[model samples]
Target: MMKYHPLPAFLSACAVSACLFGGHAQAASWKAFSAEGGQAPAPLVLPDLAGRDVDLSAFKGEVVLVNFWATWCEPCREEMPSLQRLQQKLGGRGLRVLAVNVGEGVPRIKQFLERTPVSLTMLRDADSDVMKAWRVRMLPASFLVDRHGMLRYQIVGEADYDDPAQQAPVLELLK
Candidate 1:
């Protein structure tokens, strides 16, 4: 029982190190975060369509789904109604959705709203600062923030909000 091989010795050391470092890396597997298509929405502060401050901190006690979009992006146009439906379905269950339109004017957004039933709170980054900050490379970037103002999950492209796979995390946040 006195054998000392370098590889096995290293493995024993690693096992002990892992035991000692247990639970230290609470969040280590997020290096390759993929939300629908790309990275999640960046933490940002912007104004709603009404120009009122709509920062993430303001919705601390609720599950917030912040989606970044634009009027011209076809995918953005395609997925909005689903997001609206998601809002309607989960409204009473304590879900807040902020659709942040990047760099589009109020009139354009208002005009786009006329054709869809997107009734959630619509925020506008008129100068695109939030968009850049959030690194939104795609049209419909969505982030699910928990009641504690922490981003829990995100999807970069179009997602069927009604899907159970997507809803599970959201419900968890609400709880």
Candidate 2:
């Protein structure tokens, strides 16, 4: 005879809830990389949808937002348009947003974009290698890099980039 353990079931439910709602539960704000004792970001060189290799180091003199997302992530899908708006609002002022799709083929990404339609630079991480290197545990992870190529802040989950408060960090970095 086996005793039913409520604790295990409770924990499992909690984990699922966290995955589904954690991003929204978290305050939508940038966390300072230095304050968290995070190391400089790893070298990032990935292929764009056009098969052109895009390197993070090439944008050293500009504020870069590297966003990790996937087609299946609801929060990621919800937040992408806002990211596009952010780019259009700030691109001329030296802000570049790289939307990296993790573990998805270009065709699927293209199909998603066909429906969602964002003009932000799209990059592919077909094997999720970059996601692992960046220690991303959730969808919609965003990193803000300063003009000097140093990582300044990070957002662990979905954020409305169109919001003034969210835009403030990118604006500050541009200066």
Candidate 3:
């Protein structure tokens, strides 16, 4: 019988995801893509850094940026500050940024946050179930959900959230 080690499996998955997304590395801007007839994705329910259960459904009637990331991914780390700035700029205007961390402990995440210091919703995906649910084949993949909970756009690589072009798509969704 073969045994499964979490670290190897996690690393392998990330490696493959990164390779698949490497071609899109030049895509530094968010691209707008609507789901079929604006059909929302599967329900996402995960615990926040505080251990409180946060449901994606709860964010209905608001524009939400669901970003899948990890503390170990350099690109993921790089894009976080922009996300924070985006959050700060539009948060009061009904924009919510949910940074879903895949396969990391709270202590590690907390440590990273201490250094990065982003004030946004941070969710823990210790099992990467949410990552697979969202079909996030890459680290730092992001999706834009409209006010009606429909997924309207997705970014497969690191993005400059502060860019007017990137903010425009999200801003329009909030309207």
Candidate 4:
């Protein structure tokens, strides 16, 4: 007979609750990265859909929004179009949005793109190494890096990038 462990299941439920409720409350706000005791992020280099290497360091002089997401995540899907719009509205102002897809293949990501088009730079973390390196524990996680490449603000749930309140932090970093 197999033994059942309640501890693991309880912990799993707690994690899910945290992701669904704890983070959801902050969706409309940006949390200062430094307040979380976060420092400059580690180096990141991943391949785009075309397999070309995209390095985070390359965008040092510009504000970069690094978002970790997966196609199956509902919140991730909901916020994608807003992210694209944000890029379009601010790309000329030195704001770059890097949507990092976690642990998904090219075919799946391509399919998602076909259904919901987005022009933001789509990077792949096939092995989830970059995701782990960035300590992303939940879907739709975002971190804003300033022009000097310092981590600024972050949010762990869906955010309407089109919202001026949400864009405030990005604009501040750009300045």
The most accurate candidate by TM-score is 3
Q: How accurate locally, in lDDT, is each candidate?
A: 0.68, 0.81, 0.83, 0.82
Once superposed on the true structure, which residue ranges of model 3 sit more than 4 Å away at CA?
1-11, 16-25, 34-37
lDDT tens readout by residue for model 2, 16-98: 54367656676557888755434478889999999999999999899999998877667788899999999998999999999
Each candidate: RMSD to true structure?
17.6, 7.5, 4.3, 5.9
Per-residue lDDT tens digits for candidate 4, residues 44-79, read 999999999999999989999999887766778889
Q: 145-171 in candidate 3: lDDT tens per residue? A: 888888888887778887788788888
Q: Deviation in angstroms for 110 in model 4?
A: 0.5
TM-scores of the models, in the given order? 0.73, 0.85, 0.88, 0.85
Query: Could you tell me the TM-score of candidate 2?
Result: 0.85
Clashes of each: 3, 0, 0, 0
- Please say which candidate is ahead in lDDT: 3 or 4: 3
Deviation in Å, model 4, residue 41 alpha carbon: 0.7
Q: How well does candidate 3 match the true structure in TM-score terms?
A: 0.88
Question: What lDDT score goes with residue 47 in model 4?
Answer: 97
Poorest stretch of ten by lDDT in candidate 1: 22-31
Model 2 steric clash total: 0
Q: Which residue pairs come into collision in candidate 3?
A: none
